[model samples]
Target: MPRLWTTRLLTALLLALLLLTAACEAEPEPRRYDFAIQLNGGPTGWPVWVEELTFDHTWWSPGGNLGGGFDKRPPSGGATAVLSRPMPAPSSVQARWFSYRTQTFYEIDLELPNTDALLQQWYRDYPPPDYRHYLMAGFSGEGEVYVWWRARCTVCGRDRSRDFHAPIVESAWAEEAEGDPGRYRNRTQEYVNEGVIPSPW
Candidate 1:
């Protein structure tokens, strides 16, 4: 009887340990959000024809790219697109433009927004005349949030080519929240405007 009881107790402990291990190994549900991107034609319009648009993020899943056979936008005009996916915000977006005029393809990097209060506010009131006319937005990361933007050029050359930074913004990681935390998680519907690609003449 003593031996039987010991065996039963050991079996019970083993079952409990197995349950605990399974619980620890369980993966959490993925957090989802909407990522919006906008592209403008700049003051002088798009210099090259767009061949493809690609999106890449730091997350583990596969990002996507799109084929573009679209016409060039007129001066001061632009386009907008969005992607809704799980956490791990996009690291960079690129636009591959084919310049029939120049017979070359130019890859333009789109700017991302920083996840900060002041920058978020600035994004809402974007295209501010006094500043450099930058657009900003936010996104969630593994343990942080980020704000990104594309800076506009104050001046352009006669050929419409201007020296400019690809994109720039600030980021703040979450201190309180655990797992994949996004400051904008409460916001189910928000569009991030990935700014314009200038004509590479």
Candidate 2:
């Protein structure tokens, strides 16, 4: 009787160990998301920089309302990424924007000395339909070293900033253009002036 009991106990222990191993193997670990931005192709000597890049103040997941409606808040903010300082030598600069919410990326800014070709390339990447507004900084003006981005909304006067993606730039000192190099600010301004937005800049 004692021998029989010992055999049964061993069998039960083995079964329990097998069950525990199975449970541990069944589930895998989840992946964490790291939001970031990268820059490539800027003026030869200019250093990369990012400023005023604001993300949505609030957080919302699958079923949340992520508020700040069309009347009060828009969906996003803006940032300026450029080379650290302007370089005298001829060079090209490229800036990229990252969207953590959608897991998307786009080449938003690019500048080549004495050529509009880089600007044209930017258009191909950020087509009119994909994003509502666009802004860039790659020119010198007024001695402020200013670089601005398009505000989130041109219509409904709301900033979608409550739960939106902010840009992360790789370079710095990518100055603003004298005229509308990309025409993003001008277009957004038009929308705002027409009461599309509560405030126009």
Best by lDDT: 1
Error of 2 at 136 (Å): 18
Q: How far is 34's C-alpha from truth in model 1 (Å)? A: 2.7
Backbone clashes, each candidate: 9, 28
For candidate 2, which ten residues in a row score worst on lDDT? 60-69
Clashes of 1: 9
What is the C-alpha local distance difference test score of each model? 0.36, 0.30
- Give RMSD to native, each candidate: 17.1, 19.8
**Residue 124: error of model 1 in Å?**
12
